[model samples]
Target chain A: MHRRRFVTLCGGSVAMLAAGLRGVRAEPFVDFPKVRLVDAAGAPLKAAALATNDAYVFHYPLRSFPCFLINLRKPAGEPREMTSEALAYTWPGAVGTQKNIVSYSAVCTHELSYPSKEGSEIRYAAEASPLSGKPGMIVCCAHDSIFDPAAGAPRLHGEARDPLLPVRLEYDPAEDAIYATGLAGTWLLDRFLKSYRRQLIAEYGAGVYKEPVGATSAAVLLNTYSGGAVSTC
Target chain B: MSECINRRDFLKMGGAAVVGGAAVTAGCASAGPAAVSAGFKAALPRAKGPRLVIVGGGTSGLTIAKHAKKEYPKFDIVLVEKRDMYSSCFSSNLWYAGLINLEFLADHSFLDAARNNHYIYFNATATGLDRAGRKLITSEGEIDYDFLVVAPGISYDYNRIGVKDEDTIDALRTGYPGGFISPTEHVTIRRKVQEFEGGLFLQYVPNGNYRCLPGPYERACMIASHIKKNKLKGKVLVLDANPEITIKKDGFHAAFKELYNGIVEYKPGSAITGVDLAKKTVKTEFDSYRFEDASIYPGVRASTLIEHLGLMDAKSPQKEALISQLKYNYIGDERVYVTGDSRPHPYSKSANTANTEGRYVAKVLAARAQGKDITWYSPRTVCYSMVNANPPEAISVDAGYVLNKEGTAVGGFSPDTKLFEKRDAAKGRGTLEWARGMYRAMFEG
Candidate 1:
């Protein structure tokens, strides 16, 4: 038993005596039923899913890459075991832009972990510069993190520049959920710095080096270095 | 920076914008006639030469500097580090168990290591790198590095794991994210662990590859051992990042069950989606849960430095490894080498591996300095994974020289459970001895 489930189970029992006298909501502890670790096809099930499909897209505009936007048209009453081979979405519905629904690999081209969504902006774990075939530029906020969406560069920046391996996902007809099958090799994309370098030049312009005005404008473009300066409009 | 922001704020925001690859609106708020700090400007170093700068003072950069000095005695090796004192994360668990003190784990300066080897050491931050000029531009002045090796250790994606924001990094008083970075966070987390009496000490692991594959389990053992020894009323809930774990489950189970028994609870296959700080609530894909002290380990990526340098290779096992220039790689630029925990090596992110890689990279450069067709030292890694609380189990693997082809070398790992061995009596002690030597090799200087 994971420690949380055990605590929830124990917490439930601790509150059981009180419930006998009067109906009550348990302390809302972690309740993990002893579900199988994986499904028959050997895939992981969702430990938690949103109650509604609208929850798929996060509202925070500042979210970084590798952060997930979980949504479900309908969800199960409890967290259940999921199989790796579970179907995600049927072809017709999942293809938001294309004809069929294709799975996307959330792992950054940099390291394999999901991108860390900072300040609501999901910063790409790797640079988002396009590699060759992958689309979408997921930029990591901290470093030279930029990934090109048009061509997912296997390795975004720094070292690891492999394609963002895709996940074999399909749309579920019954639940309207996107399920994953196996790991898909990542698509290649163009590098991300072209646009990144452009942004700084465009935003700050040539006037950035002047006394208070230039420094202020440049700072606006570079917060960590600028110290969050206010513009003198 | 917009109409509402100031000059300083604009610069900070602009830097962030440039970093994020966002169309930064460098629009500044009209703060009238601001004066730039002369002191800040004057602090810049007044030296000029082919300067080599390293940001991190931890295992990776420090080790590289040691060898780099031996190779280039004349080149100015400038080490810009943030931390004054360094502690061994490799042996940090012992501190939690009251086996060691901060002093015993404290790291030494490169001054000793670089004796006769002239290098400037500064406590500053490197903002950007101009690879073409081989320059490391810091808040101070630009220090040109013919060779730049970046190994800034694990910088968390706190907000991604639902910590809220970077500022909140200071707000959280408990969990693993607490002290993983600076010593302050460590002190804060220690207090939370001390204050808590019972309930569930839930440590949520995020999905996919993260820093230190077996870290959560090791931490769980440490936490559970402490709880059992102290006889706390609570059990430890380990919400794994994925089903099963990177470590051997059987051994992990045996250790936890034998030592912790009722004190630790293990949850496999659950991913932490979000965290509610105020309610101390952790929400997963399946359910909404609450905890007394929640330590959420969010998803990971290459360190900010690695990200900034644009050196990721998704296809390769060594995400942090610099592929050849045929791949237009950043490797061997002025013979630049990145090692230790910072690099996205395929092996378990253990100190053991970091130590091994540090030496391996050092050897490669040393051999290169000696003008020999070097290739004897390949990158290999071994990890001492703690199952319950007993010393730690060992998992070993290698690549390049052994696992892979391509006259190159790097770190590696495997899913095979047998790779992990139950440490025998003497072997366990031997592992500790190895860890001690590694720390000394890098830090004793």
Candidate 2:
């Protein structure tokens, strides 16, 4: 039974509080629900369009080249299990029994290369060098940063300090399409909230942004929107 | 963005008309009747002090003048620059990507920077070097210097690419601009790229050590990204004179493969022999192909100022001004210093190194003015190459130098001083900060 907690982080301050648990799961902090993963022509992503080891790159909520989707089912290979604990949501077996497919943020945790298309020419981990040993590894071509998609896209090598953030996938069997419902991390969520907050303050007034519930502290938002110019040292 | 707009608006409005090519502006204006002090305004009370004359007000020159004034209040510093404005080629790739405006790449007023620092800003070119007389000859008059620093960047050698005649050179420059170092050329390249309507977009990279090693590759990425994003039906062909990539091999090769894919085509060892202006065709050793528009980066060397000073040794095939590592002094004269891209050194020819040397030279000169002992200082350089277009993520090379047994600055030995070649997502984010930080320190500090 996973517990839900409100985590608040500012420029240099952090605090968290647990809500009364009643078998409720954590809500997706990242704003992936509204974002439609699209092809180069801005059309919705279809599950059948991707072959095994094939993936597509798209811009998500905050930044361009944010997320990517991969089809894990191979022609003559055994079905592999998803090893990533970062998977927030998955396609139900009833939806054409799709258990081997997954999607992860294309932005590399190491240097943010957007390996989906900007970083490398290879389409899948199985095609890349060194990382080819792993079944679901995605390589960030910029620094050779590798991530294991089956295991929540964790960093396998290179300088990326964190794993690729996972986006919750929802398969619509009727449309044979996959839509991103939510995300597993606070990276883009925090940026979105702070940017949204700034836009709000600029459009309305400072008084109108009345510190919503479960919101990060104002100081944290200030630093997030500060464009990284404020030097702590 | 606000500050950038405010400072750059004037340059967009007028700076374009004030200067032509680097050559046209390398002559001096008439010397005014009054003996202007440091501000270049009017006659002021003359004081007996050691004079410091710096040639070329680029990164190194400006930095030296600003630091020298702050350090030694008594020394008279004179900055001799050909143009009133400066266009930085350091981050011009961003401009090509449409991430930054062309106006932001140009600085309209070194005079303002000098005025604020109380340094004499002379809008003139240094034509000849009278090393024996300890004077610099310009169109206006001869200006004497107690200590001289030359930071006159680089000049392209068109003849190396079979462009011998002035008409052919001018045609090549006007038709296909090599947006390597100047502002006007950068704008021309930007306009050409922006106006490109889905055709064969060709780019030529030179063979030898150029201004920025990864610059051509980065531009190719940006151009391909723009085409891909806009859904423009075109192909970007990169013709390399060298057999392979000269630097950042892994990252660039990956970028070409992943991001551009079908949109970009890379051809190695395709050295351009000549270009047919009438048909827009580029002839290489291997093949001849027609191009809709092109960016041809010609072979580069130290600025003409170095040639005028007779700093290059005659026997060397590649002409570069020889200089000491510690002093950055011209090989023959200790009092005359040649820093930045103009000097031949193992260190990369970059603005960061230039700025580092500028500050160091200023400190060394201040110590010399005070009759104090000065020691060698290692200069460091950092270059950030942005890979992704929209998100603006970047990779970088950070290198530091240390004095060798012979006192020449070479690549550093220790772990902390060693070259950092790997890319970092954090470093990608840090690129903008690094650029902003350096610009702020150089201009606003």
Candidate 3:
């Protein structure tokens, strides 16, 4: 049976599964204020303009993740399935007590991973856990690690051995949303790497298929975007 | 005509260089940032004061010294070298391809640029490093540093595969794409090429990790092209340890198929086991054959210096396990940095990466000059290979460039200037330009 499915058959909600896993989110992991704006440039960029910017649509890979920032005002509220590269994260500031409201990565620092977002927070669906005390936040579904978003580190639960790879965010009040300002350079899903390895092994287990990663080829991807991704077995 | 005049002037004035020393002045002139005018200029390092010791004086070592001094000129920059002169390994393909002369393209001394910076240059080999004491022990004497940069290039291990002693290795290096750094040995290479009759000329690639991944192929193409030009009947076999031929691989495959026509036999997944140098015979696990001349390109490991410093993963006696220990990021402490071909990195060990690593380490060292906390980033490189006079193809990659992963530059050849844009070097002028560029980028402004 598929690991995720077998776990579900054992009577666990998607929420509970997320709890068991790290780097995933169910809900209450992210907080979005009702405020709205057409656009904002607080972090040297207009938030609204960034949300719909064609540059973000494709070129987001330049930011080196599956990350994206949305403008609340212009947010189609359509629950847009993010097909872009940037793994959309909340803006990079805590407006007072709202520090834990945003979610981040929970992969190990030793290795980096590009885990996509499951809910409001970006989670390695294989290794799932919340950044703070919030439920449904996944550090990585592959490895259940937790990170503290407010503190920009790992929490007691989840892949606590690893920390959240923090992506810089900025809130543009004009757009009533946030924009991805910078990257920690290592905010990859360090936990999900195992799943990716497994997937590759399963797919190319003939042992003849050799795919070297994380450096030169990684350097190649750093220069441009390739629309293909190998699934984690 | 104008370009030729400039070359002639530079060469003729090359003698005046010892006297006039313009390259050094040009190197220092560009030290100040163009942004802040007077204050920045005043704050620049005064070409004298604190000893800025740079180990390895190759691309990275020299660049960091120059760039570091530019930011904090009050500090004295001292560059140390084991060799008498500095030449570039990048664009050295021209030498192997018979495209350029080694004398013209692969020679330069840092004395000119060192004088321009008023920086001290030491001609000595670094024997040991006391990272704690911040002192570099050289053959001449021990030199202390306020800050140090190490770019030791590559140290090849020919002894491991039974090519023991200098004479045997020297005989082997005759005409095979000779090793990088101290590139003066190519003079013997030309003789070996002329001596070879009709027999197999083998490029026996050692283990996987080596200085330049594309080097073997680039060398092969050059030899094959030369063989075709000479209308030779002998076959050139490339016994590779890797699964496929790399470094602008797709393009090389095409060229090999269409151009070489059967002169070059690419034997990937094959390696040489034993050699009877006296009998002029070599044996591989796949098959045994006799070759007139062979260039055994051996596997490269980290330097003894790096291992002694405990920079690598600690291994057990059986080599079964690695000790769980933290590795240093951004090259040891802020005091000392390693770049170029010395340190183990992900990218292909090429000249461009070395130059870029030199620039990056220098940039970080530069930030430290201004009382700023510097965050260092990994170096990037794009290699361009022209397979036997065809328009070159490229492979571009930048380490630590992306957020989660990395990528490559648009590859393949084109008449349009968008992709593979770096291939636009003037036919005759590329090697010299590359060497000059590395010097200017590293030594000068």
Candidate 2 RMSD computed on C-alpha atoms after optimal superposition onto the true structure? 16.7
Q: State the DockQ, from 0 to 1, for candidate 3.
A: 0.01
Q: Which stretches of candidate 3 lie over 4 Å from their true place?
A: A1-233, B1-48, B159-178, B305-332, B369-371, B390-436
| Candidate numbers, best TM-score first, in rank order | 2, 1, 3
lDDT of 1 by residue, B301-361 (tens): 4565655555443332223334331111244354555555445334445555555565556
Per residue, candidate 3 scores C-alpha lDDT tens digits across B38-96 of 11111223335666777667666776666566545566777887877666666565565
Candidate 2, residues A90-177: lDDT per residue as tens digits? 2222112455566666555533333311123223454434323446567653334567665566566544445566666666778776
**Candidates in order, interface RMSD in Å:** 26.5, 19.6, 23.1
Indicate the worst ten consecutive residues by lDDT in candidate 2 chain B. B1-10
* Best first by lDDT, ranked: 2, 3, 1
Taking all chains together, each candidate's TM-score versus the true structure is 0.53, 0.60, 0.52
Model 3, total clashes: 75
Predicted complexes: DockQ each = 0.01, 0.02, 0.01
Each prediction's Cα lDDT score? Answer: 0.44, 0.59, 0.44
Model 1 chain B poorest ten-residue lDDT run: B23-32
* Superposed Cα deviation of residue A218, candidate 3 (Å): 47
Q: What is the lDDT of residue B102 in candidate 3?
A: 66
Question: Residue B401 deviation, candidate 3, in Å?
Answer: 4.3
